[model samples]
Target: MKTYLPQIERRILVRPNQTYGILNYDLDNAYPQRMLELVAGSPTAKDCWNKRTKFIAGNGLEEKDLGKQIINAKGLTIAKLLKALATDKALFTGFGIHINYNADFRITSVSYVKFEDIRMGDTDNAETADKFALYSDWGRKTWKNIMRSKVTFLDKYNPEPEVISEQVCKAGGWEHYKGQLFYFNPEVDDYPLIEADSVWEDFETEAGIKIFNNREVTTGFLPSTMLFMQSRREEAENTRPDADTYTGINIPTQLEKDLGAFQGAKSAQKIIVIEYEDESSKPEFKAYPIQNNDKLFETTERSVEARIIKGFSVPKELINAEKSSGLSNGSEKKQAILEFNDNTAADRLELSETLAEIFSRFYKDINPGKNWNIIPVTAIAADDNPGIKAGNAINELLQSTLPRESKIAALVYAYGFKQAEAEAMCL
Candidate 1:
């Protein structure tokens, strides 16, 4: 229904260039096959697959997932989106579904009904378990109409022409950050190879099975075929001239000027995450995408580590640091002694360590007890493209819940400030 699932759980098998937009010129006509199964729930595997089959793993029936042109026409049929154009890209661009047969199969059609997700039959009420996903008008019946209607096909001379290839996607390793892992290396050299997205490993025993970041869990993989290869390269880039070098790789005017300058912030996003206090450091800190564009460091040794967030103007060393960066119109701190009577002991101890590092940088991932973090220009990115800005601790708690907005726009990210101190820390 609303199944694009890739906030970091990825397992996709796509094959579509066009074939259901219904073709019946007789390759023998009637050659249809739709069998699908994809189950993924987070916030810790939907509490371990619903505390162990109390239920979850495809049954409620809301399995739509063929994005990049996200438009599901209900119970799918335009001939199943044009015989799924045999996984279109001229023929096929990706395929990989191995979580041991992947579980619970039976997909004869519903052209991805919205990336699959539904448990218990007759959709089990409460508005068919939160309705799931439908796109727009083209839906009104609900409860997936108890699955089973009518669809059959096989042609190219009664069943023969089937050849799909071009899949070997791998999402392996890196992104430990703290213990310092960091893989995916789109060739940023020095033997780093991140560009990741396929490293999910979650197991279960069954009995009221509870799974989600558990005794055995590893995350960050969301490549469901980059939303249908960016919707068939944006429908062959409208009419290519090179379609701006192929959709300019999914526009991001620098992430919409870094989330519109941290969502029109007045003041509160901060930076200065420079690390490496000893052991002959080297990766002082370098993250390139742009901004001068030729300095992406890493040369450490003493147990090495690296991170450098951006979006300056709130660096009183890092205010209270983390109150989960949430709390508004809110006020409740000056606890006594006449609120320190306009205090004056060396500028009131630097504004009370900038209000306790602004409550410890928005509550450090909501009250984590560790003393190490380095999110820097935060973004978990997985092919939707256009990200990499103002996630440094929720862009500093959304610029402390904007009460004085009006900075229209101003982001200086040369990979976390530096272009002349990010233009002297913007305004």
Candidate 2:
């Protein structure tokens, strides 16, 4: 037996290099980069990633101005920062924020950093990383030279104001002190695995299947066909005696060019005109009756898609609206949204808390007491009236003993009426 496919081996060996004083993310130091490419190549993975990012970000902060405040000179607001963090978190399960401080050690500006661009500095302790290395191209494919100016060293985020103040004072100014980095990794002592890491091989498999189909189509779907052509007497005689007389290389070369012309969709229904002087020199196409595996390919692709979506914890109802219909469609999607919201609540809370902590130090107006909540997906009225008609639900609400405000709330949420319309009907 022989194997044509590569064996799957997923491991994160955080090898430390004493020479560079930086730890390698996997053996090649390009795990995140490779993961990024995988996500880009797989449609299901990319869709789930976008859905996760959107769900985690939700409707932005409850306090609108707090999110509107520009965090950097480039006009990157807190909302954009939250979205970027959510994007990275959805993909890498970790995110980084570059914080710049003034001479007085007060946070001046903050910017979102690509998680793939960051590498942990070599540390004796396994639990904590004191420094980080930020380079645009960790794979070194974009910038081969990797100049000293391209690399930046940043201190890990220290919450203690007094410690940062003292360090800045010792350095003589903020100019002397490099910026700080707030790296968020839910897992301790190791680089966090991507959300879809468990089904990562499925991503590759899906991509390979697509490539196979593409090649089949491009080559005129001739994978099962073998062409056998007899050599002409004159052509055989023309061959030099010095050359291998048994093998007619020039005959195969011309046949290859003829075969190449029969490739692509344009060749479909095209007539093949082969001229031969006798039956002995006729061309024969022997097609081995290979099993048609289109159904198998489709099933495998669907399984791969489902696994990828499951790995991201996204509901099929939310991703595939076409599969749902009738009265249950809206309700099913609504329930999925609610369930997914609950599943992603922790992610939302993590972003909220991280932002709250950082902003509390940067802005006096923003504090932990102020709610830093990312608004969840609200259920629409259509979703609320599952088996019941909208008119019946509204009539029942109108006849209830509930107060005007309560009735209005029911009309808005349960019957899918706009706030103003619900209020008017209640009045």
Candidate 3:
């Protein structure tokens, strides 16, 4: 019995907020993609959901827009991870047995899923077993419900003879998962690197191997603590022409109906780009009235600009999407760049510095609401780079819902973070 075990490279980011914050992403220096980045036998889209330690991207909005966001974000990233497991479905999805590492060691892997507009995230941006328990419960309650025709069934009651272990064998107890390495914890408990597969191919091979290469990925939430897993499959099994069908810029269908006052030139019109500079942090954006005339926008609003997200306080006009009626023209002087130094990550991330400022501000704004007194998404939408878009996607991906006066403004933040992170890593 010759079993081939392909290694997976996992990439973990520190995501206190919704954005996939890269702590120390060292992909360029990692192992050769072919040497330690491919998984031989992986699960298919259908079977992947039945497992315990699986990832799922539910339609998770602010629990407020809970209704429609569900229709959009369902199965975004986790679904893709399953299909790219390995070439040999037999090897990839094989259940011959299992591997068990403890609590300190999670079964993590890396993929280009987050690189592009690779959205699709777990329900809670914060990871916990509870968020994923539904998948396990659904499978256990009615296995017959989700089983497909192409599924391989080895036996009846002995259907899962492929392995000695049952589903999730926890830290304390063990049932059918006896002879096998159920779980062993060095610090707390043990976790298995089950159906998950990790891989890395340069900017070259990523597109052809992905599931929905046609869609422009704007917003996504990913587990921040993932480990980088890498691997490469043979050309035959992994070969596929690069897909050019993806809509480069995704405009929600609903926004099409609501472009009322903001409709500029195209259905996706030009946005009012306003950039404010800060000595302490990255530049932030502000939205001006969409200039109907091109020649006018240059003189009136100036060229495009971006924001400094690390600042203390965002201008209220930006946060509320209030009309920038104050600045009638470039000459009409108003403090467009608001200063937020005494209170925020704008200064530093030290516990004493950050926390003291945070609590002090909490006391200051201890009124009702999360405080829309924050900066507007447009105030940060002043991206100068040809690539960044700053609206819902960036806010969603970055987890900052800065209000937008228009649909294009909304899409700016949604798409900006991807472009920003992409640029950051490419450098």
Candidate 4:
């Protein structure tokens, strides 16, 4: 008989730094689609996005009539829809809106399509071409689920897969392709796609991938730290020993075995009894403690979290991150918050505009040849920094030797009111 020994495995580290070949990404490929789906489906990510969306949209629609339209859409609420749309854009850089209309040429509902389930053909828009092609796997359950069907299990030998269906929207009617049903909408001819950001696309890079990566790294901190053993203890004889020596803890073999037996037991308290071979000698206990080094981990976690917050353009203070500077005072912190809001203004404006366009199109489709305008979603409520500054200026003017009319004029200009109104208030 021949005996064989297990092969020794060696760890190898390869430095491919800046030497790898570029990888290409397809806009229509499933990788990006799957990634976006994961982000949208993740409960944590969903919550973060929902809160952020509400923060941007603030409460709900500013217009009462527009709010009514959203309420009528039963399945989805205005706030929830905005949150989904914002999350879609944040993760996929683009989102789709599907407008549903009633038979009387009135918009009855509005819905959103996840980027993953959307399939677009050669046409730029889904509704533009008379016979434009668009596919949605909304109700199509995976083949694996169908294969294990209790009713069809007996037919496993001849498992006939269900045919995939497609729908076509004609000029003013509907058509089905391979079991798909589509209704044509002549009022609007576009797929209502909203892109959150525009940037260069290359083989190894994407618009939102960096942000998602940062978020992942930030969230991994706790799990990674869980692997760190924070402390250790050693028991040794009462005699002094040289610090540099390799002497091990002095414990009797039997006593060590007993300690090992308590590996995973948990109780309110534990007592250990050690007996010495010398009947006259008493057993004593002492512990030499060791602490784990975690400065690197703390620094890395904070750095990653800051990067994540930066990617979202969210204020660090909002998330309770350590203050960037020593400014612990409220006024100083307010400035930081104001700066963050200012930096986010552009992105918020873009989201509002995108939402406005979708709502406008829905209104137009609902009421053809009617003059109606939908109010655009407002960005985060304006900060009162300007108002505070105006008040300070007014106080300064009052302290000066300027005439009453001059003060009133300054107040009128600063507060955007008529001179008479300012005088009346000042008086």
State every prediction's TM-score relative to the real structure: 0.14, 0.78, 0.15, 0.42
lDDT of 3 by residue, 122-171 (tens): 33543322111101111223454523332211110121323213332432
lDDT of the candidates, in the order given = 0.22, 0.80, 0.24, 0.41
The 10 consecutive residues of candidate 2 with the worst lDDT sum are 321-330
**Residue pairs whose backbone atoms clash in candidate 2:** 381-416
Worst 10 residues of 3 by lDDT: 303-312
Candidate 2 local Cα displacement, residue 220, angstroms:
3.8
The superposed Cα distance between candidate 3 and the true structure at residue 277, in angstroms, equals: 79
User: What is the Å distance of residue 425 in model 3 from its true position?
Assistant: 50
User: Which candidate, 1 or 3, would have the higher TM-score against the true structure?
Assistant: 3
- Candidate 4 accuracy as TM-score: 0.42
The TM-score between candidate 2 and the true structure equals 0.78
Which predicted model would earn the best lDDT? 2
Q: Candidate 1 on 167-242: residue-level lDDT in tens?
A: 1011121121101001111222111111011111221111113232131122221111211111111132245567
Order the candidates by TM-score, highest first — what do you get? 2, 4, 3, 1
Superior candidate under TM-score, 1 versus 2: 2
> Which candidate has the highest TM-score of all?
2
